[model samples]
Target: MKFFLTKSYKLFWVLIPLVFMYGLFNKEHSLMVNIHATYFVINHLDFAGLIVIFFGLFGLAYWLMDIFNKKLISWMTAYHVFISIFGLLILLVFYDEVENLEIDYAFKQTLILLMLITAGVTVAVQLLFPINLIVSFLRKKKH
Candidate 1:
């Protein structure tokens, strides 16, 4: 786990497969919407693009992690990566439920609110990057 986060290229390699898997997912969803008429009204591209953007930002962050410093607070990377992924999973799951569950509108609205909050938090957590950088740059010399 430590190596995964600290080694940017290794993590990037991991991310590539995830991105491709997501691409296949989107392709399947696209087929459903087009041929099967699945009634899944979610903009398939937007969701796919969301995943792409997520990976893109992570890749950039990890690369910067390499450039700015080889080390990071292990817990910080763990929290950021896990929570961001968790939030994205929640978003995708709730989106599917809200769209396809055939539940009450009120329940769906609640789900939407949850989605909104999760997204806000997911985005907010990225603020840690700059925070980490500030601390990194501001540190006094060991000499």
Candidate 2:
């Protein structure tokens, strides 16, 4: 259990999955489609909101790549957490425009907020929990 909380393990299971989920959401939202159709360009808020979402998705992909390459060391995880927070902040900053989309905006906002919170919580757990207990225990030879 504790071994799973280590930087490498957490990077694989937690951070990677979170970033993948972010990418999934970004694709599902079809932000590019909205922009190309001009639905997001009609207003300043919408344009800015769409831009933020794109940046967030970009950051998420970058982070995921880092994890996939086994490059997310402990310090890197800290950076990744900040990036995730920034992504969340971008969404929060544009909440008003996001809430105005044609779909059930309220539901969308709630889902995004929940995902952001869960990502944050997972990072916290990865950092705070005993990460290498299992590995350490296994390394101890029996008498």
lDDT: worst 10-residue window of model 1: 30-39
**Which lDDT tens digits does candidate 1 get at residues 1-143?**
76666764455446556755665665545312222454445555566566667667777877775776645666667667777667766665455545566778899777666777887898888777667656656765322
RMSD of each: 6.2, 12.0
> lDDT values of the candidates?
0.63, 0.43
Model 2 agreement with the true structure over 1-143: per-residue lDDT tens digits: 22322333333334434544444454423332133347642333343444445445534543443354422234444444444445444543444445555778678867657655654664454442223223323443422
Overall local distance difference test of candidate 2: 0.43
What's the CA error at residue 41 for candidate 2, in Å?
Answer: 18
Query: Model 1, stretches more than 4 Å misplaced?
Result: 8-13, 27-42, 140-143
> Taking the candidates one at a time, how many backbone clashes does each contain?
0, 0
lDDT of 1: 0.63
Model 1 CA RMSD to the hidden true structure, in angstroms: 6.2
